[model samples]
Target: MNSIPFDIVGFDLDGTLIDTSGDLAAAVNHAIGTIGRDPFPAADIHPFVGKGARVMLQRALDASGGYDDAMLSALLPILLDHYAQNLAIYSTPYPGAVQALDALAARGVRIALCTNKAERFTIPLMQQIGLHDRFASIVSGDTVGVSKPDPAPIRAMIERAGGGRAIFVGDTINDIAGARNAGIANIAVGFGFLDGPVEQLQADAVIAHFDELVPLLERWPG
Candidate 1:
């Protein structure tokens, strides 16, 4: 092990901190149904996640059959409406999620939420999961001029949180790319929506569960 080396920890909300697939699926299906198209299975939509809302919508619409710009334009609103309506119904933190955050807080680590999810949905989701209070900084996709993979979001979180040693935990390529772009180390989790081996993501580390974070943080150079 290279040993964890950071004081502040940043987390990607959707796949890393929360299991949002169910809610996302519900919204996707609702959109399809509203457009008079066949609803796609949750499995089919899972791969479309971790990108962004627009990309997910495009992927979902395409996978269902085929959707031209006109169809997609009409379906997008219904999808967002569905997600807004059923936001918290099926969404929840992963196992050990709360405890991990608690433990990190106890250790005096400054925690930040650096998510590509839009602010309209991000804030409420964190509140629902009881994690809003745990974060010293909450940087959403809409917070800055640029989103993940652009490094601005991560950089914003670190700067807003007082800027020190930091680590990022996420489950997607964008996460890895953003971390790299921000010049920070990243940790990838196995339980999230990413489609392949954690190693292929090229993150600094990869762990299987939330509690594993405790030990990693303990040994980090904070």
Candidate 2:
């Protein structure tokens, strides 16, 4: 029999499940470079993540130099186009992510992913990374006309995942807040692209590695 407490397990895409900083930095750099700005190192781009591309690019542009509305408007599409074509070039699953997913699946837990990443990028990126089929649901930022920190997407993810007791795992305020808004328990990954310390997200639980996930949930009273 399935022993895990939750029937559904939801995840955040970028930092939680995959390390996408390299590709994201590349896209941001491509946009900023058009204005003759220097590129940001991939690791430096981590904190500016968790939101969507527009916000991410805005932070990058703000950090590199500055931007006006007109300049940002012009560069947004550049960043997005570069990103769309190069989604998974440097993206890879976080260490032990695959094993965690496999363990969840083995125990009959339904896996779902919700991301602030829009459908255009999220879907293709997951497909390229060979994870699209593993999820029972994928709720993108634009999926329900709202995104994380709003609870709609998280709720939608659970419903689509064939709902039951659910727990969310992610790396940002958006994820923790979203799950809380949706009335589910949450776990925060210590190694994700956290803008601040992972504890600040205040997830119900915190894990430093995917290897700790199954054990964590196994202890959940649910």
Candidate 3:
């Protein structure tokens, strides 16, 4: 018998399941470099993530100097191209993420992915990391024609994952708030690209490491 409460568990891709800050910063630096802007340190890129490519690039540009619509429009594709090509170079799963996934599978919980990253980038990144087959469903920013905080994509993720009771795990407002918007339980990850304190995200629970995930899930009341 499955001990976990939810039949399906959905996660946000970039910050929740993987640490993409390094490669993302590298791509941002690559785009900004073409405009002669100095590169930002990878650690500096953490807060700029979890939104999407455009927001990430815009934040980078805003930090380096300032960006006009023309500058943003011109540089978006360059950053994306670089990211697509080098997606997995510096990106890796957070500690115990794979083990957590394995434990969930062992409990017969169907895992799903819902991320603000575009399919063009998300699919390939998962492939390179060898985690593509783990998710029963993968929904990108553009997958359902709307992104998180709107609830459409997440709702779609549940349906596509063979819906039942579901809970979401994420690292940003888009993830936690989106789960709330979808009327499901949510857990926030402390180590992801948080823009503020982890508690500010307002998730039902928070975990600093993936090792704590399964035990936490097993204790879920709902």
Runs in model 2 deviating more than 4 A are none
TM-score of 1: 0.93
> Which portions of model 1 show Cα errors greater than 4 Å?
1-5
What is the lDDT of every predicted structure here? 0.86, 0.92, 0.93
Model 2 lDDT per residue over 1-222, tens place: 888989999999998999998999999989999999998888888778767788898898889888899998999999999999999999999999999999999999999999988899999999999999999999999999998899999999999988899999999899999999999999999998878888898889999999999999999985
Residues 112-154 of candidate 1 have per-residue lDDT tens digits of 9999888989998888867798899999988997899899999
Best by lDDT: 3
Deviation from truth (RMSD, Å), model 1: 2.6
CA RMSD of each candidate after superposition = 2.6, 1.0, 1.1
Backbone clashes, each candidate? 1, 0, 0
Taking all chains together, the TM-score of candidate 2 against the true structure is 0.97
Candidate 3 lDDT over 93-131, as tens digits, reads 999999999999999999999998889999999999999
**Cα TM-score per model:** 0.93, 0.97, 0.97
